[model samples]
Target: MSTVFDFAANLLGGGEKPLADFSGQVLLIVNTASKCGFTPQYEGLEALYRQYGARGFSVLGFPCNQFGAQEPGDSAAIAQFCSLTYDVTFPMFAKVDVNGADAHPLFKFLKGEAKGILGTEPIKWNFTKFLVDRKGEVAGRFAPTTTPKDLEKEIEKLL
Candidate 1:
Protein backbone atom coordinates (compact mmCIF):
# COMPACT_ATOMS: atom_id res chain seq x y z
CA MET A 1 0.00 0.00 0.00
CA SER A 2 1.04 3.60 -0.52
CA THR A 3 2.49 5.28 2.55
CA VAL A 4 3.55 8.74 3.70
CA PHE A 5 7.00 7.94 2.33
CA ASP A 6 5.59 8.38 -1.12
CA PHE A 7 5.41 12.14 -0.75
CA ALA A 8 8.10 14.81 -0.49
CA ALA A 9 8.26 18.49 0.53
CA ASN A 10 10.58 21.30 1.48
CA LEU A 11 11.73 21.48 5.06
CA LEU A 12 11.69 24.73 6.96
CA GLY A 13 15.46 25.00 6.83
CA GLY A 14 15.57 24.61 3.05
CA GLY A 15 16.03 20.98 2.10
CA GLU A 16 13.97 18.38 0.35
CA LYS A 17 12.50 15.89 2.83
CA PRO A 18 10.39 12.86 2.22
CA LEU A 19 7.87 11.58 4.69
CA ALA A 20 9.54 8.19 4.28
CA ASP A 21 12.34 9.52 6.45
CA PHE A 22 9.84 9.36 9.31
CA SER A 23 8.95 5.78 8.69
CA GLY A 24 8.82 3.56 11.78
CA GLN A 25 8.02 6.41 14.16
CA VAL A 26 4.72 7.52 15.54
CA LEU A 27 4.12 11.06 14.34
CA LEU A 28 1.91 13.87 15.48
CA ILE A 29 1.39 15.92 12.34
CA VAL A 30 0.07 19.39 13.02
CA ASN A 31 -0.79 22.42 10.89
CA THR A 32 0.52 25.44 12.75
CA ALA A 33 0.13 29.23 12.54
CA SER A 34 2.32 31.55 14.59
CA LYS A 35 -0.33 34.27 14.99
CA CYS A 36 -3.29 32.06 15.74
CA GLY A 37 -4.92 31.91 19.16
CA PHE A 38 -3.84 28.29 19.40
CA THR A 39 -0.22 29.29 18.95
CA PRO A 40 0.38 28.56 22.62
CA GLN A 41 -0.16 24.92 21.85
CA TYR A 42 3.40 24.89 20.56
CA GLU A 43 4.66 24.71 24.11
CA GLY A 44 2.65 21.61 24.76
CA LEU A 45 3.59 20.10 21.42
CA GLU A 46 7.28 20.72 22.03
CA ALA A 47 6.93 19.21 25.46
CA LEU A 48 5.47 16.10 23.96
CA TYR A 49 8.20 15.89 21.36
CA ARG A 50 10.98 16.21 23.95
CA GLN A 51 9.36 13.63 26.18
CA TYR A 52 8.81 11.03 23.49
CA GLY A 53 11.37 11.71 20.78
CA ALA A 54 13.81 9.20 22.22
CA ARG A 55 11.06 6.66 22.23
CA GLY A 56 10.27 6.93 18.50
CA PHE A 57 7.80 9.80 18.48
CA SER A 58 7.98 13.10 16.65
CA VAL A 59 5.94 16.25 16.09
CA LEU A 60 6.02 17.48 12.53
CA GLY A 61 4.88 21.07 12.27
CA PHE A 62 3.63 22.52 9.02
CA PRO A 63 2.87 26.23 8.80
CA CYS A 64 -0.41 26.84 7.04
CA ASN A 65 -2.12 30.11 6.01
CA GLN A 66 -5.48 28.81 4.93
CA PHE A 67 -6.97 29.77 8.25
CA GLY A 68 -7.74 33.49 8.41
CA ALA A 69 -4.29 34.34 7.04
CA GLN A 70 -2.88 33.59 10.46
CA GLU A 71 0.33 32.42 8.84
CA PRO A 72 1.19 35.01 6.24
CA GLY A 73 4.94 34.85 6.49
CA ASP A 74 7.43 33.07 4.28
CA SER A 75 9.40 30.03 5.43
CA ALA A 76 12.14 32.02 7.10
CA ALA A 77 9.67 34.25 8.93
CA ILE A 78 7.65 31.29 10.09
CA ALA A 79 10.76 29.58 11.37
CA GLN A 80 11.85 32.70 13.23
CA PHE A 81 8.47 33.23 14.84
CA CYS A 82 8.21 29.60 15.96
CA SER A 83 11.72 29.49 17.38
CA LEU A 84 11.52 32.83 19.13
CA THR A 85 8.02 32.53 20.45
CA TYR A 86 7.80 28.90 21.50
CA ASP A 87 11.30 27.46 21.38
CA VAL A 88 10.04 24.72 19.16
CA THR A 89 12.73 22.16 18.35
CA PHE A 90 10.78 19.69 16.28
CA PRO A 91 10.85 19.51 12.51
CA MET A 92 8.98 22.31 10.76
CA PHE A 93 7.95 22.27 7.12
CA ALA A 94 7.28 25.07 4.65
CA LYS A 95 3.97 26.91 4.53
CA VAL A 96 1.19 24.91 2.92
CA ASP A 97 -2.53 24.98 2.32
CA VAL A 98 -4.38 22.33 4.30
CA ASN A 99 -7.74 22.61 2.61
CA GLY A 100 -9.35 23.37 -0.78
CA ALA A 101 -8.07 22.50 -4.24
CA ASP A 102 -4.53 23.67 -3.62
CA ALA A 103 -3.95 21.59 -0.49
CA HIS A 104 -0.72 19.69 -0.17
CA PRO A 105 -0.90 16.13 -1.38
CA LEU A 106 0.33 14.78 1.94
CA PHE A 107 -2.39 16.65 3.81
CA LYS A 108 -4.99 15.50 1.33
CA PHE A 109 -3.96 11.92 1.96
CA LEU A 110 -3.97 12.50 5.71
CA LYS A 111 -7.48 13.93 5.68
CA GLY A 112 -8.71 11.11 3.52
CA GLU A 113 -7.19 8.59 5.89
CA ALA A 114 -8.92 9.98 8.93
CA LYS A 115 -12.04 12.10 8.73
CA GLY A 116 -12.80 14.51 11.56
CA ILE A 117 -15.90 15.41 13.61
CA LEU A 118 -19.09 13.86 12.27
CA GLY A 119 -17.13 12.38 9.39
CA THR A 120 -15.89 15.66 8.01
CA GLU A 121 -12.61 15.56 6.10
CA PRO A 122 -12.03 19.29 5.83
CA ILE A 123 -9.66 20.80 8.37
CA LYS A 124 -11.56 23.48 10.28
CA TRP A 125 -8.67 25.60 11.46
CA ASN A 126 -5.07 25.88 12.40
CA PHE A 127 -3.64 23.45 15.00
CA THR A 128 -5.76 20.54 13.88
CA LYS A 129 -3.79 17.35 14.60
CA PHE A 130 -3.47 13.92 13.06
CA LEU A 131 -1.89 11.12 15.02
CA VAL A 132 -0.03 8.62 12.87
CA ASP A 133 1.23 5.29 14.04
CA ARG A 134 4.63 3.76 13.24
CA LYS A 135 3.17 2.00 10.25
CA GLY A 136 2.09 5.33 8.71
CA GLU A 137 -1.56 4.56 9.31
CA VAL A 138 -3.63 7.32 10.84
CA ALA A 139 -4.57 6.59 14.44
CA GLY A 140 -6.85 9.52 15.12
CA ARG A 141 -7.67 13.12 14.31
CA PHE A 142 -7.92 15.92 16.88
CA ALA A 143 -9.76 19.17 16.54
CA PRO A 144 -8.08 22.57 16.83
CA THR A 145 -9.54 23.04 20.31
CA THR A 146 -8.25 19.69 21.55
CA THR A 147 -5.31 20.78 23.61
CA PRO A 148 -2.08 18.86 23.12
CA LYS A 149 -1.90 18.01 26.82
CA ASP A 150 -5.12 16.06 26.55
CA LEU A 151 -3.52 13.73 24.00
CA GLU A 152 -0.76 12.39 26.20
CA LYS A 153 -2.60 9.22 27.04
CA GLU A 154 -3.26 8.48 23.41
CA ILE A 155 0.36 9.12 22.55
CA GLU A 156 1.49 6.94 25.42
CA LYS A 157 -0.66 4.16 24.09
CA LEU A 158 1.00 4.40 20.70
CA LEU A 159 4.47 4.63 22.09
Candidate 2:
Protein backbone atom coordinates (compact mmCIF):
# COMPACT_ATOMS: atom_id res chain seq x y z
CA MET A 1 0.00 0.00 0.00
CA SER A 2 1.07 3.57 -0.67
CA THR A 3 2.02 5.29 2.56
CA VAL A 4 2.21 9.02 3.21
CA PHE A 5 5.91 8.72 2.51
CA ASP A 6 5.08 7.92 -1.09
CA PHE A 7 4.44 11.60 -1.77
CA ALA A 8 6.54 14.70 -2.28
CA ALA A 9 5.81 18.43 -2.31
CA ASN A 10 7.45 21.72 -3.22
CA LEU A 11 8.58 23.89 -0.37
CA LEU A 12 7.62 27.54 -0.21
CA GLY A 13 11.26 28.58 -0.21
CA GLY A 14 11.96 26.36 -3.21
CA GLY A 15 12.96 22.74 -3.85
CA GLU A 16 11.01 19.57 -3.39
CA LYS A 17 10.70 17.59 -0.15
CA PRO A 18 9.66 13.97 -0.14
CA LEU A 19 7.28 12.90 2.58
CA ALA A 20 9.57 9.92 3.14
CA ASP A 21 11.96 12.37 4.80
CA PHE A 22 9.45 12.62 7.59
CA SER A 23 8.82 8.94 7.97
CA GLY A 24 8.66 7.70 11.60
CA GLN A 25 7.47 11.10 12.83
CA VAL A 26 3.99 12.08 13.88
CA LEU A 27 2.73 14.59 11.32
CA LEU A 28 0.04 17.21 11.30
CA ILE A 29 -0.64 18.12 7.69
CA VAL A 30 -2.76 21.15 7.06
CA ASN A 31 -4.01 23.09 4.03
CA THR A 32 -3.45 26.68 5.04
CA ALA A 33 -4.41 30.17 3.76
CA SER A 34 -2.85 33.48 4.72
CA LYS A 35 -6.04 35.51 4.44
CA CYS A 36 -8.53 33.02 5.76
CA GLY A 37 -10.26 33.37 9.13
CA PHE A 38 -8.23 30.43 10.36
CA THR A 39 -4.94 32.09 9.50
CA PRO A 40 -4.23 32.78 13.15
CA GLN A 41 -4.09 29.07 13.69
CA TYR A 42 -0.51 29.31 12.50
CA GLU A 43 0.41 30.51 15.96
CA GLY A 44 -1.18 27.53 17.56
CA LEU A 45 0.35 25.21 15.02
CA GLU A 46 3.76 26.70 15.64
CA ALA A 47 3.23 26.14 19.33
CA LEU A 48 2.32 22.54 18.72
CA TYR A 49 5.42 22.08 16.63
CA ARG A 50 7.59 23.59 19.33
CA GLN A 51 5.92 21.54 22.00
CA TYR A 52 6.18 18.13 20.38
CA GLY A 53 8.74 18.61 17.67
CA ALA A 54 11.48 17.13 19.84
CA ARG A 55 9.30 14.10 20.35
CA GLY A 56 9.06 13.17 16.69
CA PHE A 57 6.23 15.53 15.79
CA SER A 58 6.02 17.92 12.87
CA VAL A 59 3.54 20.22 11.15
CA LEU A 60 3.61 20.44 7.37
CA GLY A 61 1.68 23.37 6.01
CA PHE A 62 0.39 23.60 2.46
CA PRO A 63 -0.97 26.91 1.26
CA CYS A 64 -4.07 26.82 -0.91
CA ASN A 65 -6.04 29.44 -2.83
CA GLN A 66 -8.99 27.16 -3.50
CA PHE A 67 -11.11 28.61 -0.72
CA GLY A 68 -12.45 32.14 -1.38
CA ALA A 69 -9.10 33.00 -2.95
CA GLN A 70 -7.87 33.49 0.57
CA GLU A 71 -4.31 32.62 -0.33
CA PRO A 72 -3.59 34.58 -3.48
CA GLY A 73 0.01 35.34 -2.63
CA ASP A 74 2.93 33.83 -4.51
CA SER A 75 5.46 31.65 -2.69
CA ALA A 76 7.60 34.64 -1.76
CA ALA A 77 4.65 36.55 -0.37
CA ILE A 78 3.41 33.49 1.47
CA ALA A 79 6.81 32.88 3.01
CA GLN A 80 7.20 36.51 4.07
CA PHE A 81 3.67 36.72 5.47
CA CYS A 82 4.14 33.57 7.52
CA SER A 83 7.47 34.67 8.92
CA LEU A 84 6.50 38.26 9.77
CA THR A 85 2.95 37.61 10.84
CA TYR A 86 2.85 34.39 12.82
CA ASP A 87 6.55 33.64 13.04
CA VAL A 88 5.72 30.18 11.83
CA THR A 89 8.70 27.85 11.92
CA PHE A 90 7.12 24.69 10.57
CA PRO A 91 7.74 23.52 7.03
CA MET A 92 5.36 25.13 4.51
CA PHE A 93 4.81 24.19 0.91
CA ALA A 94 3.95 26.06 -2.27
CA LYS A 95 0.31 26.76 -2.98
CA VAL A 96 -1.79 23.82 -4.13
CA ASP A 97 -5.41 22.92 -4.90
CA VAL A 98 -6.92 20.64 -2.26
CA ASN A 99 -10.05 19.87 -4.21
CA GLY A 100 -11.25 19.17 -7.76
CA ALA A 101 -9.21 17.95 -10.72
CA ASP A 102 -6.09 19.94 -9.88
CA ALA A 103 -5.71 18.68 -6.35
CA HIS A 104 -2.25 17.70 -5.17
CA PRO A 105 -1.51 13.99 -5.02
CA LEU A 106 -0.65 14.16 -1.29
CA PHE A 107 -4.00 15.78 -0.56
CA LYS A 108 -5.86 13.29 -2.71
CA PHE A 109 -4.29 10.58 -0.60
CA LEU A 110 -5.13 12.38 2.61
CA LYS A 111 -8.79 12.89 1.76
CA GLY A 112 -9.01 9.26 0.81
CA GLU A 113 -7.48 8.18 4.10
CA ALA A 114 -9.79 10.28 6.23
CA LYS A 115 -13.11 11.44 4.90
CA GLY A 116 -14.76 14.50 6.34
CA ILE A 117 -18.23 15.08 7.79
CA LEU A 118 -20.75 12.43 6.65
CA GLY A 119 -17.90 10.61 4.86
CA THR A 120 -17.43 13.36 2.26
CA GLU A 121 -14.03 13.41 0.59
CA PRO A 122 -13.82 16.99 -0.70
CA ILE A 123 -12.37 19.53 1.69
CA LYS A 124 -14.90 22.25 2.48
CA TRP A 125 -12.40 24.97 3.30
CA ASN A 126 -8.84 25.85 4.15
CA PHE A 127 -7.01 24.82 7.36
CA THR A 128 -8.38 21.32 7.05
CA LYS A 129 -5.91 19.07 8.88
CA PHE A 130 -4.94 15.43 8.63
CA LEU A 131 -3.01 13.73 11.40
CA VAL A 132 -0.53 11.04 10.46
CA ASP A 133 1.11 8.61 12.84
CA ARG A 134 4.79 7.71 13.12
CA LYS A 135 4.26 4.90 10.64
CA GLY A 136 3.12 7.35 7.93
CA GLU A 137 -0.45 6.18 8.29
CA VAL A 138 -3.32 8.64 8.38
CA ALA A 139 -4.64 8.72 11.95
CA GLY A 140 -7.43 11.29 11.91
CA ARG A 141 -8.86 14.25 10.07
CA PHE A 142 -9.90 17.53 11.60
CA ALA A 143 -12.23 20.12 10.15
CA PRO A 144 -11.33 23.76 9.61
CA THR A 145 -12.97 24.62 12.92
CA THR A 146 -10.78 22.20 14.87
CA THR A 147 -8.07 24.29 16.45
CA PRO A 148 -4.49 23.11 16.60
CA LYS A 149 -4.47 23.50 20.36
CA ASP A 150 -7.25 20.94 20.53
CA LEU A 151 -5.00 18.42 18.78
CA GLU A 152 -2.26 18.28 21.37
CA LYS A 153 -3.70 15.29 23.16
CA GLU A 154 -4.04 13.28 20.02
CA ILE A 155 -0.53 14.24 18.96
CA GLU A 156 0.84 13.21 22.34
CA LYS A 157 -0.77 9.84 21.95
CA LEU A 158 0.98 9.28 18.64
CA LEU A 159 4.28 10.40 20.09
Candidate 3:
Protein backbone atom coordinates (compact mmCIF):
# COMPACT_ATOMS: atom_id res chain seq x y z
CA MET A 1 0.00 0.00 0.00
CA SER A 2 1.06 3.58 -0.61
CA THR A 3 -0.69 5.93 1.76
CA VAL A 4 -1.80 4.73 5.19
CA PHE A 5 -5.39 4.80 4.01
CA ASP A 6 -4.54 1.93 1.75
CA PHE A 7 -4.02 -0.30 4.75
CA ALA A 8 -6.29 -1.93 7.33
CA ALA A 9 -5.99 -3.25 10.88
CA ASN A 10 -8.12 -5.23 13.31
CA LEU A 11 -9.51 -2.94 15.97
CA LEU A 12 -9.37 -4.06 19.57
CA GLY A 13 -12.61 -5.93 20.33
CA GLY A 14 -13.85 -5.06 16.85
CA GLY A 15 -13.59 -6.02 13.22
CA GLU A 16 -10.99 -4.82 10.75
CA LYS A 17 -11.29 -1.15 10.01
CA PRO A 18 -9.81 0.67 7.05
CA LEU A 19 -7.43 3.52 7.78
CA ALA A 20 -9.54 5.38 5.27
CA ASP A 21 -12.11 5.69 8.03
CA PHE A 22 -9.78 8.39 9.33
CA SER A 23 -9.27 9.96 5.94
CA GLY A 24 -9.13 13.77 5.80
CA GLN A 25 -8.07 13.87 9.43
CA VAL A 26 -4.60 14.24 10.88
CA LEU A 27 -3.47 11.05 12.59
CA LEU A 28 -1.02 10.06 15.27
CA ILE A 29 -0.28 6.38 14.98
CA VAL A 30 1.55 4.90 17.95
CA ASN A 31 2.96 1.54 18.89
CA THR A 32 1.89 1.27 22.50
CA ALA A 33 2.59 -1.08 25.39
CA SER A 34 0.93 -1.76 28.73
CA LYS A 35 3.81 -2.30 31.11
CA CYS A 36 6.69 -0.23 29.79
CA GLY A 37 8.16 2.82 31.50
CA PHE A 38 6.67 4.79 28.65
CA THR A 39 3.27 3.24 29.20
CA PRO A 40 2.07 6.33 31.03
CA GLN A 41 2.30 8.24 27.81
CA TYR A 42 -1.14 6.86 27.17
CA GLU A 43 -2.53 9.68 29.30
CA GLY A 44 -0.95 12.33 27.15
CA LEU A 45 -2.12 10.59 24.01
CA GLU A 46 -5.67 10.49 25.30
CA ALA A 47 -5.44 14.17 26.17
CA LEU A 48 -4.39 15.03 22.70
CA TYR A 49 -7.20 13.00 21.21
CA ARG A 50 -9.84 14.58 23.42
CA GLN A 51 -8.49 18.07 22.82
CA TYR A 52 -8.23 17.77 19.06
CA GLY A 53 -10.72 15.12 18.10
CA ALA A 54 -13.36 17.68 17.28
CA ARG A 55 -10.82 19.45 15.09
CA GLY A 56 -10.47 16.48 12.78
CA PHE A 57 -7.59 14.78 14.47
CA SER A 58 -7.30 11.30 15.95
CA VAL A 59 -4.86 8.97 17.62
CA LEU A 60 -4.50 5.34 16.63
CA GLY A 61 -2.81 3.01 19.08
CA PHE A 62 -1.43 -0.41 18.25
CA PRO A 63 -0.42 -2.48 21.26
CA CYS A 64 2.93 -4.14 20.74
CA ASN A 65 4.88 -6.70 22.74
CA GLN A 66 8.00 -6.70 20.64
CA PHE A 67 9.79 -4.45 23.10
CA GLY A 68 10.71 -5.81 26.51
CA ALA A 69 7.65 -8.04 26.52
CA GLN A 70 5.76 -5.17 28.08
CA GLU A 71 2.42 -5.67 26.40
CA PRO A 72 1.67 -9.26 27.14
CA GLY A 73 -2.10 -9.08 27.07
CA ASP A 74 -4.92 -10.24 24.88
CA SER A 75 -7.32 -7.85 23.17
CA ALA A 76 -9.82 -7.79 26.04
CA ALA A 77 -7.18 -7.27 28.68
CA ILE A 78 -5.51 -4.51 26.71
CA ALA A 79 -8.77 -2.71 26.10
CA GLN A 80 -9.68 -2.91 29.76
CA PHE A 81 -6.30 -1.66 30.95
CA CYS A 82 -6.27 1.27 28.58
CA SER A 83 -9.78 2.19 29.55
CA LEU A 84 -9.56 1.66 33.30
CA THR A 85 -6.01 2.80 33.83
CA TYR A 86 -5.49 5.66 31.38
CA ASP A 87 -9.11 6.37 30.49
CA VAL A 88 -8.07 5.95 26.87
CA THR A 89 -10.92 6.47 24.45
CA PHE A 90 -9.03 6.68 21.22
CA PRO A 91 -9.16 4.01 18.57
CA MET A 92 -6.88 1.12 19.42
CA PHE A 93 -5.82 -1.76 17.18
CA ALA A 94 -4.75 -5.29 17.97
CA LYS A 95 -1.18 -6.05 18.93
CA VAL A 96 1.34 -5.80 16.14
CA ASP A 97 5.05 -6.05 15.50
CA VAL A 98 6.48 -2.70 14.56
CA ASN A 99 9.80 -4.12 13.39
CA GLY A 100 10.33 -7.64 12.14
CA ALA A 101 9.67 -9.89 9.19
CA ASP A 102 6.03 -9.84 10.27
CA ALA A 103 5.70 -6.11 10.76
CA HIS A 104 2.30 -4.75 9.85
CA PRO A 105 2.09 -3.39 6.33
CA LEU A 106 0.97 0.03 7.55
CA PHE A 107 4.03 0.27 9.79
CA LYS A 108 6.30 -0.89 6.99
CA PHE A 109 4.96 1.92 4.83
CA LEU A 110 5.23 4.39 7.71
CA LYS A 111 8.86 3.50 8.39
CA GLY A 112 9.72 3.86 4.74
CA GLU A 113 8.02 7.26 4.68
CA ALA A 114 9.60 8.57 7.87
CA LYS A 115 12.76 6.76 8.86
CA GLY A 116 14.19 7.36 12.32
CA ILE A 117 17.73 8.48 13.22
CA LEU A 118 20.27 7.68 10.49
CA GLY A 119 17.35 6.85 8.18
CA THR A 120 16.72 3.60 9.99
CA GLU A 121 13.43 1.93 9.17
CA PRO A 122 13.27 -0.27 12.24
CA ILE A 123 11.27 0.98 15.20
CA LYS A 124 13.57 1.34 18.18
CA TRP A 125 11.06 0.89 20.98
CA ASN A 126 7.53 1.08 22.22
CA PHE A 127 5.59 4.35 21.90
CA THR A 128 7.31 5.17 18.61
CA LYS A 129 4.95 7.54 16.81
CA PHE A 130 4.16 8.29 13.19
CA LEU A 131 2.22 11.46 12.42
CA VAL A 132 0.06 11.40 9.36
CA ASP A 133 -1.35 14.42 7.61
CA ARG A 134 -4.85 14.76 6.23
CA LYS A 135 -3.83 13.40 2.88
CA GLY A 136 -2.73 10.12 4.48
CA GLU A 137 0.92 11.06 4.12
CA VAL A 138 3.33 10.11 6.81
CA ALA A 139 4.32 13.61 7.89
CA GLY A 140 6.72 12.98 10.73
CA ARG A 141 8.11 10.33 13.07
CA PHE A 142 8.79 10.75 16.79
CA ALA A 143 10.97 8.66 19.04
CA PRO A 144 9.61 6.66 21.93
CA THR A 145 10.86 9.34 24.31
CA THR A 146 8.93 12.07 22.57
CA THR A 147 5.80 12.61 24.60
CA PRO A 148 2.44 13.18 22.99
CA LYS A 149 2.25 16.70 24.44
CA ASP A 150 5.47 17.59 22.62
CA LEU A 151 3.66 16.99 19.36
CA GLU A 152 1.03 19.70 19.89
CA LYS A 153 2.58 22.26 17.60
CA GLU A 154 3.02 19.86 14.74
CA ILE A 155 -0.47 18.49 15.20
CA GLU A 156 -1.83 22.03 15.20
CA LYS A 157 0.06 22.72 12.02
CA LEU A 158 -1.65 19.78 10.39
CA LEU A 159 -5.03 20.72 11.78
Q: Report the lDDT tens digits of candidate 3 across residue range 1-159.
A: 479999999999889999999999999999999999999999999999999999999999999999989999999999999999999999999999888899999999999999999988999999999999999999999999999999999999999
For residues 47-152, what per-residue lDDT tens digits would candidate 2 score against the true structure?
9999999999999999999999999999999999999999999999999999999999999999999999999999999899999998899999999999999998
Clashing pairs in 3: none
lDDT score of residue 92 within candidate 1: 98
Q: Candidate 1 has what TM-score?
A: 0.97
Cα lDDT of model 1 by residue, 55-120, tens digit:
999999999999899999988899988899889999999988889999999899999999988898
| Model 2 CA deviation exceeding 4 Å by range | none
C-alpha RMSD by candidate, in order: 0.9, 0.5, 0.8
Error of 3 at 116 (Å): 0.6
Least accurate 10 contiguous residues by lDDT in model 2: 150-159
Full-model lDDT, candidate 2:
0.96
Number of the candidate with higher TM-score, 1 or 3 = 3
TM-score winner: 2
**How badly does each model clash, as a count of residue pairs?**
0, 0, 0
Cand. 2 TM to true fold: 0.99
lDDT of each: 0.92, 0.96, 0.96
